[model samples]
Target chain A: MMMQRRLTTLFALALLSFVAVASSPPSSRVVADSVYAIPMLTLRDQQGQLFDFASLRGKPRLVGMFYGSCQMACPLEIEYLKHLQRVVAAGSGKSISVLLVSFDPARDDLAMLRKVAGEHHVWPPAFRLARTERGDEGMLAGVLGIAYRQLPGGGFSHNVRVSLLDAQGRIVAATDASGRPAPAFLRSVDEALKNP
Target chain B: MISRQLALIPMLMLPFAGKAADYVPIPAGQFESALAIAGHAAKLRLAAFSMRSEPVTNAEFLVFVRQHPEWQRGQVPSLLAGANYLRQWQRPLEPGESVLPDQPVTQVSWFAARAYCGSEQARLPNWYEWEYVGAADATRADARRDPVRNQDLLSAIEGTSGHLPGVIGTRPANVYGVRDLNRLLWEWTGDYAAMFPNPDARVPGSVANLALCSGSALAFADKNQYALMMRVAALSALRPADTAPRVGFRCVREPKRK
Candidate 1:
């Protein structure tokens, strides 16, 4: 019996070692379809017009998820993601947009999403504040792997992760915005795009 | 002299021993197990790993309670204890009885994940390192047919609402060669919940005022539940502790020298 448990431990250790080696950065190839972008409903833009991911299917997005009321990391994360956009445009000479999704659906209405955009000096088509529906907020929580519970007055506990998707609407990568190195990730994506 | 040359040949072979490097860069969901297929990640200098996975399960967590029992946040760690380790696990039946052994463990506290990892001669994967690991692209899942892709079922069941945990393993491994890195549950890392420099989400300003005011921050960082947003918020705090229900872990190591 002792030997058997030892074997199990050995097995687990071996598996972990093999896994550790097998896991590494992906090589340039057909970018996988990981990030799923099928929007539950058409989100409204700053002007309250329907924003369709399908319409922009061909281009990739540097998507950001945050609430308008957040005064801490969310604002900073949003700024960082936008900085990637700026850096991407400046370096690659190509246009990429950031989509800021709010965790606080109750607070972030169409008007609120737009107000935050304006306050931050974001330009046209640079970013979109996705309006939340009754249950849609939970839907997003699932899609993005971000979880938050509503606090007493109206706060939430959430993480900062920004996703990158290829033109085919698959999840390419979801970068952690907590201590995110946005430009490095973008540079890798830029490299992936350049390949082939 | 011929025999002496033969002995030298064996010495040369000894230096080139062990498993051949299997680092292949492919999209997610293509490899059989993301964890299984990923090669050694970028050298883990200064990066630490959680001793274990997320939400250490009931059966596993119960064992923890048996040892320390003080982690219940002033409540009895064993109060809800059934057959599981910690009393924290609530669904899919208890451990050794459920089908979630491979699922990302949940319901852990930083304290718990930390303790477990240390005992095993491992540590929590650092935040950036974990991100780089989870970021292993999975869009090319079918070709690899990895167990990590098993998470697809949960997402499909959730109906694109992105609310439920995806089933484990049906996709390829990321470049890190990690399996099931994404779909099991939000994992715990050594990073804290608060932003940089401070690294203490448990502190007042670490998490936003919303979670800070209600004392939910404690529960938020409970290490169980793997509550996506809360866990993400805790990324900045990085408090450390022992294991819990719904929490399990994988270990990382540097590539061995030839």
Candidate 2:
């Protein structure tokens, strides 16, 4: 029985090493300070494909949170991001990616994500609207300095603080996405994209 | 071999893992929060939920870190917790001699607090839920109106000032059978930051107002509820990743679907 157990343990070790070898190495070890060091947060985008938040580590991205049913501020947020994208592309000839995760996961399902994306004329890959498929959405919100509270009537009271992450997922700059992107914020985005 | 040892951690933690019934049910009710926006006191409705009777103790959190190593002091990313995260503990896994096992754990960030609660299949109580529970004294629910009781609470908070909080359950549970709701430590409500104390948030078209859609500026319903107001102000001043020497948290669970 002892010998049988030994063989089983040996088999497990071999399998573990094999699996480790099969997985792709991170571009670089995620530093303890980086937000990407957050446990693997799997997000389902508007296209309904599951992608890990860590996958965006090697590039600069604009990250924020919004709810699908938000009548005013959320739509304005999308527009502002699009405007930022256009301005950045026009000036720097580089397109920065965007990720907007939902605050209301119960209501912001696959259909809601898709519907919101369609209405804003935003699409995935370059721009994505997503819901947390697994992991703590509040942790992400907290990291990004976003605060939200659900009101009595099912509406959310939230802030539109969008953060600009460097290639390492360190927040380099942030701005209230309620209006046109601040010039200082635009400068940081330009700077991050250049370094990336 | 390492994996085998790690797998035994659950069994090791069995002794420290308190009963699941540690959570006491808080009945549903409506109450006017001290802080409402635009001088309007919005009567908020709360759903019946279960809450941890006592604040999480240091010994219990030590076991939690042993199981989820990523949440340990040095292992936690800076984005999720401040540099002062778990500073009182001698080591990542040891609360040490200076810290008592049953003493409430403090120096925790909101993110860390949320993650700790999440491990128990629970979440941090919302501000309203917290306030609702905090309203109780030994005999009566909604004891905020009693001048003597409020003075006693204020004294208790001031007494613990400049020192670590004492062990949980030193006093009897309130009417809801929950101990140390707002007495020992300033607990992290899930939506602590959602309370906008800034007057600018009330302005209809201001940048702050725009950022906070459907948001109203918070106003205090009663100036006499100084203790609760102090907590709101202190909590609002902290960033999510920021940790404090006096801040700790407890968990709450929604009722099971029939």
Candidate 3:
């Protein structure tokens, strides 16, 4: 009888303990979710065709920001992207995908962005241009993983970044055009391609 | 500690991260600098950084100039005249775009640039720091070249393609965790004397005055000599007296103010 009573008491303690543990939030020691759940954007090019980022999953992507009228940084950006392209192609004979998103969507209309697109020789999957709207810009901005703030003076301030989405559509790393020094971005993309 | 508290007493009157404008960093080349510019609503803060690997951008400068028009007229602090090379006060382009919103803000005097920094709650960087980042020869020189964008980029309105609309906030940033330090426009620095040929005259009146020099000593002794001549040439380029269509500026924030 005593033994039975002891067992019952032990069982009650175990149940209480389990409840106590489960009731509380997960402890810091517990393995947590990954830090980055980088998102992919859904966009349409100047042609108004559906541009789904999910389709580009599985390879490293390079994105450049500029509008048609950008005199200073845009040209340099395009120059460096092309330079990065040749260097990567020369080394691996693999062509990388480049995206040009016009922050000035109002002026960089579909036709205008397309003209720039055609000028860049962008077709199907090689290179592309995207025009965004102020209303849906958040969605586009969210996927690119950058935040933009419009200044009172009609200018904008945004976190300037190029996110390299892995094949799984996870952002592996982000780099600045000037920050990577060419070799790093080229080597990284090539490396990401091979290992992936 | 007491003085610091006194400084904060005035700040206590202001809101936290008060309505300063936001700024995005253009990425620099190579391993990114851990430094970040935090933009919480209107306030922009340069988190403590080891060094800025790139010069400031035209877009960033435009914010400063617009907030402080006095900079446009060159009524700002300077130990010497034209200490900071502010070349132009610019108007926009063409029939509709006369304000040149997309062009880099130019014609900023060093004094003006400094005032802009102060307004942003930041400071212009010392010449050593500015030169170190802007002049460093890194592994990559700007290598990307899109022929179409290049040929068509110039303001050749009334040409085949007419004009390409000016764009802001859309260029790829550099790797040093900086944006558009080069090719976009020239950056102003706090170190004018060290940068110009006339080191003696370049010294700010604040520093020179501390040493106790008279007005005669401060004047440009000669308009001759290559040094003086170069000073004038650079001055023409750097002074805020003239506003150019192409000039722009970047700003720096000094932590732990003196």
Q: State in Å the error of residue A145, model 3.
A: 5.0
Instruction: Identify the leading candidate in terms of TM-score.
Output: 2
For B104-148, candidate 1 gives per-residue lDDT tens digits of 445455545555454334455544445444544545423222444
Model 2's DockQ? Answer: 0.31
- Give per-residue lDDT, candidate 1, residue A125: 75
Each prediction's whole-model lDDT (CA):
0.47, 0.82, 0.45
Q: Give the Cα error of residue B79 in candidate 2, in Å.
A: 1.9
DockQ for all models, in order?
0.01, 0.31, 0.01
Q: Per-residue lDDT of B14-33 in model 3, one digit per residue for the tens?
A: 22222343343322333211
Model 2 agreement with the true structure over A1-196: per-residue lDDT tens digits: 9999999999999999888877645545786667788767889999999998888888999999999999877888899899999999998999999999998999999999999999988997899999999998888887887778887778887777788999988889887775567788889989998898
Candidate 3 global CA lDDT score: 0.45
**For candidate 3, what is the recovered fraction of reference interface contacts?**
0.00
State every prediction's TM-score relative to the real structure: 0.38, 0.86, 0.34
Measured over the true interface residues after superposition, the C-alpha RMSD of each candidate is 16.9, 3.8, 20.4
TM-score, model 1 to reference: 0.38
TM-score for the first chain of model 1?
0.71
lDDT of 2 by residue, B138-186 (tens): 8998998899988888888877764788878779899999998767889
